[model samples]
Target: MLSGVGACPAVSAAEADTTDNAALNDANTTIIVTGLKPDEGQNKISQSGALGAKTLFDTPYSISVIDAEDITRRQANSIGQIFANDPSVFSSAPSGSTNWWGTQIRGLGVRNYYIDDVPLLLYWGGDFPLEPIESVTALKGLTGFMYGFGAPGGVISYRTKRPTAEAMLTTEIGYRTSSVFYARADAGGPLSQDGRLGYRVNIGGEKGNAYNQAGINRLVGSLALEYAISPDLKWYATATYEDSNLQHEPFQFYWANYVGNSLPRPTYDYEKLNVANSYYKARTLAAATGLDWTFARGWSARLTYGYTNKYHRSNKMFVYMRNQAGDYDGYAYNFAELDQNHFGQAMIQGDVMTGPIRHQIVTGASFQQTDSAFGYNDRDYYWGNDFNGNIYQDQPFRVTRAIRFGTGGWPSKEQQRALFLSDTLHLGEHVQAMVGARHTRYRLADLDGNPLVDSGYRTSAVTPTLALIYKPAPYASLYGSYVEAMEPGSRVGGEYANVGEVLKATLSRQYEIGAKYEHRQFSLTLAGFRIERANTIDRLINGARHLTQDGLTLYKGVEAIGSYRFSDRLKLGAGVLHLGPSIRNVSAGNEDLRGNIPAGAAKWQLTGSAEYYVAAIPGLSLHGNLRHSGKAPTSDSNTLYVPAYTTANLGFQFNTLIGGRKVTFTGNVNNLLNAKYWTQTNIGEGINAAMSVRLSL
Candidate 1:
């Protein structure tokens, strides 16, 4: 990892210069592994959430890592796109609205995001940015013990690229369909002798009409710097900013509220669904400072403080042309919102041996708070008009503008405090066990930011994790683990007599068993898991009605992941996931839905990618990838479905020495077949493509 005399809390700084190291044992250090060559084999993930740097084979949980080098070559435009191809992840393309950042892992919504294991809350930001990020680590099960209170689905951890030991500069330019263009520059290096100080910075912007009238106007930048106070201590800070003005691009169905034949999915040239004048814009700024202290004799501490602020406004509009007539008014709404979040954490770790058993332990405390406000105004432009003309026929219609916003006030306020402890026990040469627990104090307030009742509804819960592992050979590892997570209860107000009362935190659990095999330059992982949670309902107890938690919503699945480096010129990767979800012991009202497939969920998903360098072209290669999702139920009623879909992509890359500098040019044609499909509640689709050039200095 990046350090002076020992492993610092951060990863390594020379990630860009390593290419011949293919061994996983030495790959745990921080460096965005860019899988650009066959020798570049190790794509190590961040072990912060796991308490130590363990390779994928050494870790007890199912996690996946794909570094930035892999991402840039894949033509992924957003962080979600980079991970969406994994079958285990359920991703929806952003409509550039409040729900843009939504992602579901293991059948549950995942909201907790981390940078180097530190928590961050994006209360109102429509999207989770991919800018300035160098690598990504995704935890695929309950993570309450690893982070704190959050969805049971898991956590997405991001690591920013550290300053390179050698100074260099890189610039990239790209263009896509719909008249969009972008440019970015990256530079980093040490600023003092013995590398006592270093810095890395990234700045970029994109503009013009992009993908279906979303009309993009975006800017992103970040600066990260670190200073070594001594051989045993260091200080680091980063400031990041992003701003965007995006036109609202609504999905055609808006199906959650209106399903079945009565509300037919609309179809128009996918490009026409976006109103030229409708828009959603937002800006976010965040800064964080941290300390990494390493004491003599296996003891160290890591701490960080962070602050984030965001503001956004939108004039959201959606057009449905399936049933249409003369120009009728379209639905529109205006909203303005703001959010602020403060986060902090302090952790200490130590290594010691008890007799023949060795122990590695970590203890930490965390705090997070968020305050937000929002308001909206609604209007119907078609309210005064009849059918003007059909939009699909290219009949131009006047775009309405609304500049007024309703008064806004704080609608929500939340705070959480937590203390956690974890230990890894080494019992023998081939056996190890991990145990951990977290105690959390959490509370929520009403819109007025006041307690629901007297002092407000406050509660606490304890979550734990246990795991055992065995490694019979250097190349193989097997493990089984059980973990539980919690989510704050649904809060209600004044209408009820017990208004101030708060339901206990809902508990969710997961049990998993997995095996990992690493031989030569290939890696494979196979696992099976089951997840469950209980639902609370009113029941008669002693002739009196009381809320009782019972019944189970269960999700079970099996998954396989593998990657191979066949030769100096060939590389390939693939994954498969399947889930079976059902509700058992449901209440009378939901009895009929028992065993029914859940809504917006695909039973099967698969992804694969390959790259082959051509011996004949000297510096040329072809790359292709495919993604598939099985048909999914559109709603809880199971009366309608979103058909199964597959998307194919093909691209090519050419690399060569240009004036003593290396330059790579690449391009891809996404949705190459233009197959119409629904990404969610939408029903219009089209062909998309992007091309870019990168020059290294």
Candidate 2:
């Protein structure tokens, strides 16, 4: 607990003085258990990803935590791979697109993501490898009441590793299919004898071919520092840098836009399907700092600030469209963009008493701003040809090069500010009620200095939440909640009457009820939720996305996640979920789409994992996984569908001593069946294998 007292929720004056110097400093250090002496609050819920550091059973929400061990065991390198274990989410993108975090949660795109509880706008455009990530928390459903302005999809908070109490160093070497090889290092230690100042650092690099003969090269590095100024106060800071390049962009397909008619999805050989000589280059730099303080009994305060900058450019020609005959109509475009983001938050939390009722309250203010500029340079030449070789074979760089085009504006700037308050009132020892609200002011500005309708407009909203939880027993809890959110809207296209106009923020609501049970090392959760968004629309103009609000969009789903420890040597983890989304209420002309399933939304998802440790062998372990995603709509008409597919993976780990130090070796094979299927439109990676070795001292 923040009070540093016992497991009890109550805070004593003397114990509160000890503060949360160690707890508040790390955004995710609150609930996750790790290291030699696992955190005492592992099974006990903490407000780590929510309003405060309160027990989970006392709170009303559906949440999931993915820890580092899970990451290592899965060998998941991308956001898509990481989410393969969770049925409640879909992580996939067009092969040639640079959108990495383009995953969907509960049938809605995760438009934004957070780092250390600080939002990083436009996350997809600037992808970061999971080299140093320590853990992640998925907070599902309406969150504006606890957070601020954001998509109703949910919030994903990424927490990186911090300095450990004990000095440590590790080195690893890994290999993947397509001749990819990489190396990494992690080291940390206390900077002072008093155990107050500490630091952790990670550095990694890779160079090799990626899927579909796409050459790849990249480097990633990060640094984390922490200083305990006093027993009651602490400060922390982090900085990161990443640079990546693709020698040849991967293959991309526009099913409906291409071919212009319904036809079975096409398949191509790995070497014969990708663009040749096309390239994508991206670079990013980020920094963050924060402070935590406990100044009075039963009270604590925190402040955090972070900033990020990204630059990306790409030129490719292999991305194409197919006519009725399946003949290719090649496309060539030069894309470039610059994005900058800033975030800040301040919070105060404490315990208060109202007669016989005990209330835990948290109040906070947060601000976020993003400035971006982007444009595409088009080519004057075109190619109409198709041969197995045409996919990856290039005529000449000069012939396919994109020429500078007329000026095209961008979404220059967006800002959001909000204040939120929440309270957990103990109705009795076994019953509690959680309530919260948020007021947000959001605005977007046009940098081209154009004065069009809805240009430089501002909008405001107030969202609220209420939930009740009943802890019938220490090992089980039941809860239900109702929450709402405000999602910033988009600017209308020039095709519309009010071109260059900004739409009012979309209002979304959610209802959820769930149960959680935890015993020893086993845990299980079952949840059902429904989400509705007002004013939703999706349309296409000249093969480009033109989004506008019409009426409403409703998405609902149910999911179950659980882990079972069968014995000291065996364990299992699994998840299953089903989602149904439809475009409701629309104009007369667009009524055909009403009651239609949203394109790209999957109907069912299931995942299972198993592992075993060999006691006699002392350091050997075995692991395997199975994942299935049912058929998904590929077009607004719902007639074009991507067939359902299943994939399996197997791996094993061996830990032993190297010169009296610890060394771990791992090997995994993915796509055991080499299944041919599409994840996004026509994007898919066939069979692949990887292995890694790590030595610690």
Candidate 3:
């Protein structure tokens, strides 16, 4: 059973400011907490973290904070691995035949990724690296009301380490199976005599191999600078670069008729068959600068600008064996493709306070452009009679030589412009309200100078959100919200019949209600939400064309999370999630996709973690985690399924003094039992175990 800490009396509206002042004075003696502090009293309710920082424990939302200590304890090498312990979140290979992992939240896709307070639009196509991050925050549910133009799924914000007043240096090296190697170094301090100016730099690289014989290699680096021009104005800039070379494995699917069957299947030599003959290369660079100013009274303003460029190329080879007279021989089917993109954005935000009402406002405009070019070259080879005979006997064969060339053209470009505004109002001591809206226009252009069918075609949409928060006391709060969102449609394959027709944006609506409770040693939250979408895109039975008019989908679910401290040296965390059935409606002529559970939507999920201090040995601790995911349908048909599975992990940490200097050592064993299970039955792939060690100074 969980017990809640009683709430404190709500401060009167007239005395709220006085109460804040007193709280601020009391905090002066306490240690400053980084990345969790509130901005100011006037910005409290409307601000993202404005609510009492410590009171986050009381919020009724599915939230997880991967703090610095967790980062070290888990030996996390990338952002994708950081949330592996969270039951609701799942990581899988990208569908585009790449090595990158697509992290999903509550069965919905995450579209936007943020660094610090700025948004990074280039999360896809394997652009950014997870190194150089100090911590990551995962917020579930509709946060569009706070961040603007985000997925209903959730948002991940990564906060990078900044130069501290004190100088520091750190480095690490590690190795794993398949000759994998990892190395990283970071250093920073004041660049000038005055602490007002500072600079920090980071560099890292990795090379490794996967269980399937695929190779991975990448290099990552970043630089940041901060300057305080005066007491009221400040500026900061950050830049990052990443390059990766990866070998990809093709997906395999089994026949639906084969279920719970045991047979000694023939194992083909993957290397000999060259079944996974594909390689991808990508490079990305991005930079951002921000200016902040404080005015007289309780007025402040901020402006930020960012730009990114990404390039990718891939080569794939297909192999097939044909039986002629008697022997087996190999034939090759190959293709090569390339893609490039450039993105830029700018935003301005401000806040102000009036007599009894405090208003937090964010108004900004942004533009993004993406250009891609794809042309494939193919080859075909034939084996002689000798090899054909081997094939007849079910013997392995290899492609001696072949030559073939094929050509197809795919050149496309897209442009988008958007503007958004939001305001949060404090009605009184116990109630707060927030309302916001956004407008966006999108355009797609053809490769030739001539206008594409949908060229110059424009669609505009307005999304609004409303929220009410009632905090009767300091330790508990209840909230409910209604939000509207939309996803733009692409003009691919000339699907839109009315090229000149102005189409409205596809729209989605979400309704949510939840409550939060917090105590000195425990916290809990329970939330329920429903989401509906219209004009969802779908394909015909033949899969030759797409129909824009036949798309509709609905998703609803309940999520609950809690954390409790059992003792001064022990703690526990747990969560449970249940998603309702998803439904789709379409014309009868189309594929039979009605009454099917949504792909990737699990019915039940659970996660729990425990931590304990080793009283017998000082400075030693142990941690363990367990995760379970329920069965899920593979596709719209819902005929095929992937059975549920659970995994466990264990680790240990120790703190000691080396030459009178503080140091920490950590080790972890992921997949403690080394279980073999398929996450996606349709995709036919599985993840193996990993062991890692790390030292921090």
Candidate 4:
């Protein structure tokens, strides 16, 4: 292990220059391990390398970044709320107050929760508070090569607010028509005379009722600390805690009820669900510690260790009434889960000039282990009769009639180890080339130490990336690249019948190309991509509930993103996506899923926003946002479709002098049209208008 302090003035100067350029310059740059060194400009770290942002703009990939400014302008209540203006992303279901809606990127299942540079795979339900976030970066496509394993659809990374030397405080409170209340506080600055030691903390809480008669209450807290051991060495630690309790009404699919045409309004009984006390409660705790070492010359090293624990319990009752005789039968379910994870990473980075070839290189190793335990206990109940569609039960049903169904109990664990090498080669003054490759090996095992799947299930992969950037001028650049990524499959258990060990997991691959243009006050990016995956996983129509198989799927699309600074007081940003055709292939018995478009892949999506700051009003500003999503099917059955919908949002904020102190007032109206739209049909939830207020000092 490398420890202690090392001296190198050259390394410090070079690192300082890189960090300064990224922080002070507004231009996009690649984000890589070395590119994120402390002291960089205003969180200007790259998503990939030092110039990663520029490269991302030019590459043939659809991506989006929600900056701090965007969050404030939108007055977003939750992360899912921010997605309302994003077309390429959609949610599958609502977690009520406890869970975030599952996200679908590029028509593929993907999770959108991350802290610092680590992925948060376990879903504890509810949305993460935005108080401690600096920015949200979304990469579209198979990004396993950059962010590590899992879905090929893409990845989302949230950079948390770090401790700063400057002290600042902000507090906000808001309310909506749905009887929701929100409050948050953020304070940070140096905790000691020496700025080397600093601290930051953020707290947020919310309570609300929804149009669907559900209710939500949530709390979040985060803390960060940093200590400078010496000029050449530093250490930092961060911790976050979240708790959410939510009651939600189960969605009733109207399209499914009408078969081909749209059905009438649903008679949702919020009272019955409340009586059943259908709700879910979840808690998550995460902590991380990291150390940075600066060496003499042009070299540095960093190590980070992190752990996360998540616990969730949910109770829901589902009823299907037969006839109008006040008769009904349903199942009440209680699910409990515990997920624990540990992650470790170590990296060495340096710059060198070998003859005429100038090179910047980074090599790192990482390991992640996730262990999870899941259990479910369910009971069956019945009502004497059903009065039309009413859910009133006149008599108490039998309790002992509930049999102890077999329990699905197991401790599943997955481990991944990876080594990667990346280099940026300067080809003369105006041109540069980037090439990198990563090798990863992963293993999975059940609690009993038995093999979870076949030999092929334990696998390794080599992913490669290449890109070229030509900067003819100081303020502009043109770039393009080719990249390939892979995704591993899940291991099957021995209890599954009929499925041979040979068919345990799934594998995925993607190919992409694109271009970007950047100028002083405006930036535009357009990219077209084709993605293909083999050994894809799909559920069989009549097979066991969890049964899945290796198949093939293809998705191709084009996306455009642009942002323009009209003036010092006005700015505009917009994005549009068009997917050509998405198809799925399954076995003969799985014909039900063949030839139909995948769920969540809309043909068209559009989003645009405008913001204006009024100097006349002094610290007053106004913002408007619009979003539209095309028709989308609920499943491969293609029998049901969620119609296209559009929504608008407006917000205003200003600061006032009160009693010799500065006070800020803010307000927002979400869903300005109060449009009744189904974000996800399977979940039977609709979007409604809401308003809120905030005051800060």
Candidate 5:
């Protein structure tokens, strides 16, 4: 069984400094493990922004971790694939989409993501190669107190692979459906004999045809270096580069503006259609450096700085159905944008005592700046006529070759600065209380020199968090928490009356209570949560659509998940989530939208997984997964719906020794039944397969 393949949260700087070297040495000895280790702390919890670490039973948050082993076993190539079985996360795009990273957590949209605890300013257009990542930590609910400023959807952090104490090398090759092949190499060792200086390097590339005759190509590389000056001080740096292209990709369908109240059937055979002249290209370069120092016993401090530059360009069509006959108008747009981010954070944490109360205090400051600019040669071209083609027929690039246009010249800049502090008081052995707050200053400027956004927008807010925990036993606990968060409002698109306008910052709040149990062979977590926030919506005013923020959006849900190890050879895991999300208190032309379910929010979700080890064989195992999502509203007004769907996956792995070195092989058939389904309300996904082999020396 895959006994040790569950969430293994995170660790603080001091805790990592004490355990990483030893753990790395032990990890390289085997490609798989039969059971969990005592020191793994699989359910421990730590905030990405250097918050002090705590065991899962003591922390007052819902968190999950996906490690490298799980990534390899599942052959996951994108963020959506990594969390497909998680009931709480919903992806809005398929893996091949340029905006695949867009997701909704607990019914709210996620606005930011982190790399090695440093927040990067990303919207819906970035993806990292999984080859060099160590783990991914997903913290659910509001995060303003632990983090500085963000959406209420949750926090996601990625930790990159690091140098190992012992010399090691591994090579792997893989194949996917439709003639895709790839290879990768990972090597790490100490540059100095004393093991004080170490380095790790990874490189990979892939190129092949995709399921629907689309083409895919990718190249990625990363390097990480660590230097330990002494037992109490350490410094590290990391750099990564990725370039990828998706050719002949499909576009998202939009029918709200064209149809009154009609829902289209999901009958398009995506596996056979090839829409030419539609492609996406992205290039990313990023670097980060950090220092960790243990100044005294039970006291530590950390400082980190990171920078990212991302460029993406795409030309894709948007389809708008006209009538029940499926006739549609196709509009293609050529778009390109450049985004740059600079981020820095400094933090200190330590333990102190006052009489009988023990306090763990943490304080930090963080700042981020982002600059965005659009290409000058961008263009939007229309086909010859309004009704160009039908959805059931294939449209080629030649149909729009004669149309020409040019669009461009827009830029915006944003800055955020925050100071945060938290204290967790240990009241005796069974009770604890925690309080935290973050004071943030945010500003957005329209660099386009347009009067539409006069002096831009400036705001300040103080978000807070409070929590209480009671431990009935060392392995179980009950806790409750409340948090407040903030996010900058979205910029109005060109089609809206308020183009180039920047709205005021939005505020969100959340309340949660949960219970957790982690014993010898089983683990369980149950939580109920409620979130409220204001959203940006567009309404027809005076025959023109204007973007405005009004009313409140409410999301209340219950989640239950657990895993059990029935024996040495069998393991099972399952989770279920039910969400009640709606919009309320709207006036003007949008009163009809009140009490309607929001788009992309599923009312119910269920997931199950199983892994079994062949006790008769030395090193062989089988695994399977199932996921179901209920029907979801396709629009904010609930006039359109996407029906419920289910997908399943099956796979197996084998490990053996070859030439006195460890070797492993794995294979998987995703969508084993070749289920035809929709990833988003309008995006479709097809069946695929993957197989790989790895050799360690």
Candidate 6:
């Protein structure tokens, strides 16, 4: 019999990083696992929708899984902070700013995210709390065959913490940076004597002055319930809420009407500059329910539904620098934003044999409806203020008006329906092939507050995927895949002439080849990929700037990530990425810009980590991380660039038994050298530190 498919093979237990938090004993333990783990069976599983619960070994995708233990080690609070060491993810904006400043994966903007495989409504980036998540999986490249109607860049999926069979409770207190304090609690266990009902709860809060000397606050709460209806069927439900406030959030710098050839270094202090208004508030609520059933020996079915509601109130100020002298004109914009989504899906998979060949087949259908609303009146407002200030000056923040809740009106609505099917053919003991396609129907509408004047676009597409896998050795797998995706057109920003106009839908394609190897104490993964998509560029038309789809953009890259356990006390991991991005096939008027490097594309990135457990100390470990980012083009024409930089981080953890209870302490310092650097084109950050103490009961 054949087991489930995985991207990579499993490793020995001694090489894996394991903790006894759930089944603790008298023995002291050290846990500092990061990135991909060397675990077996269910612990090594990467949730691949339609492909089943496959491990990393034989799967055809280039994916990375970061567990909760790694997240804690880095003290990541937002999505930007989570992948700080990943070679393939580049932050598009500052980490401490609004959630919209998301990362670019493989030189492409992130357009899709999922919670437990259910798609979310967040079209941009997300800043959801990480305390309640068990793990995060990043699947690189196009995923239209698996997930419909999304960007070609990649997909970010979050796995939530579920109920445990054994009762468990843990609490922790932490502090970060200049003056931030926080506490968190997690509890899970069986709720019924029969062990058929279980529950999990998580809650946390943080508040204090951030590195910028601005007030920052966050609160999160979540609950999960599970019930076993039968030996083969299980039902689960979850609800989560998060609220955050950042006083003086840094607004992203947009180059609309600029005269300078290059961006200048900040003349003011990185942390002390107050560019935006008083504050920005964001609130998120999500709920999901699903069922899993195994009706037969080799077949199973899953049904799921999810809903998400996100709200944001921003009173941000935008300043455009006009010259090299740091002089600028500033404007204030106030708006309330809302995003909502309702998603549902049904999937089934099973195995069968025809003659000498084995086939694992999967089929699924999904539907999602999303609504986005924005308001500028009835409490919200925007202005081309007469205020003018220099970047080196300490200008007073523009006062904000009061906000009347529930006064916003829906402006945009989108609906997507998809049907997909895939088959994995086990040709022999050493070879497998996969083929799949998804048919999607997408509709978009613009409601101008008049029921009679609804305008929109309707389109349909069929995206497909093909892959081949070869296993020459039990511990090694080589594969190649091709995928295509359809993305919805984007609306023009307020700075453009056709501000509210939506362009036609675009298509993207990807070609990838990868290899994975795992043995006793060593593991390695290497991949090469290329993606092509229609470029969206701004052009001067009729004396006005308009954003339109034109020409083509190409992104090609090679990435390698691996880990090795040199000894029982020593381990090392590293990753490297190289990218070649360019533009092509532009109009004659823009011929000079052809073959130029795309903006925000870094040429090279290297990241490495080392961890060691002290033999003399019972349960003490030390870990360090280093990253180097190469120079990146700041403009599409490649006329400007941001210098390369390197950063280092160091941390330590210790565990001990106090009063017959397990207690642990952790501390870390990011940017240990206190080097100031720009995270993006114009976004920069100051050094920070974090420490926490946790107790298990």
| Rank list by lDDT | 6, 5, 2, 1, 4, 3
Q: Residue 226 CA error for candidate 3 (Å)? A: 1.1
Poorest lDDT segment (10 consecutive residues) of candidate 4: 1-10
Candidate 2 lDDT, 1-697, residue by residue in tens: 1111111111111111111112122211112222112232225434443377655555577765565555665676755566666778666653224664457777677765677776665553524556767766667777877777778878776777788777878778998876889998888889999989999898998888755566878899999999999999999998878898877655445554554444434453655555566666778777789999998999999888999877766554443445434445555445566778898888899989999899988998888888876552233212223323243344333334344422344546788888888898988788889888888898886655353634556888889889898888776788899998888876553323445556777788999998877665566778898899875555666666566678677788888877766665676788888887887887886888889877777879998877776656656677788889887776666756677888888888766555555666888877777777766534566678889997776
The candidate maximizing TM-score is 6
Model 2 misplacement above 4 A: 1-50, 94-97, 123-126, 258-268, 316-328, 376-411, 449-454, 491-501, 535-546
TM agreement with the true structure for every prediction: 0.85, 0.87, 0.78, 0.81, 0.91, 0.93
lDDT of 1 by residue, 496-545 (tens): 23433456578889999998766565667788999987654444456643
In model 3, which regions exceed 4 Å deviation?
1-63, 78-80, 94-101, 116-127, 141-152, 248-277, 316-355, 373-409, 445-454, 491-504, 535-549, 590-592, 681-697
Q: Count the backbone clashes (under 3 Å) in each candidate.
A: 10, 4, 12, 29, 1, 11
Highest lDDT scorer: 6
| Candidate 2, RMSD to the unseen true structure | 6.9
The superposed Cα distance between candidate 3 and the true structure at residue 368, in angstroms, equals 3.2
State, as a TM-score between 0 and 1, how close model 5 is to the true structure: 0.91
Which one wins by lDDT: 2 or 3?
Answer: 2
Q: Tell me how far the alpha carbon of residue 524 in candidate 1 is from the true structure, in angstroms, after superposition.
A: 0.9
Give the CA lDDT, 0 to 100, for residue 157 in model 3: 66
**TM value for model 2:** 0.87
TM-score of 6: 0.93
Regions of model 1 farther than 4 Å from truth: 1-45, 50-53, 94-101, 123-126, 257-268, 318-330, 376-401, 404-407, 450-455, 490-504, 534-551
Q: Which residue segments of model 6 deviate by more than 4 Å?
A: 1-24, 27-43, 123-125, 256-262, 267-272, 275-277, 376-386, 400-410, 449-456
C-alpha lDDT score of every prediction, in listed order? 0.65, 0.67, 0.54, 0.58, 0.72, 0.74
Model 4 agreement with the true structure over 1-697: per-residue lDDT tens digits: 0000000011111112100211212111211122112322112234542123333323334456665545765666554565655666665553343333356676766653566665565554525557777767667777655656666777766667778667766666776556777788777778888788998898988787765567767899999999999999999998888887776545222222223434233333444433234566778777889998887687888888888777776554434333333233444445566777888888777889988888877778888887776552233112221222334432232223333322245446778888888787877777778887777787765543345453334777777767776767533345566666656554443223322233443456665555555444555566677777653333534554334654466777877766666666676778787886555667776666676776556878888877676656555667787888788775556666667877677887654445433455667776676665554433333444444343333
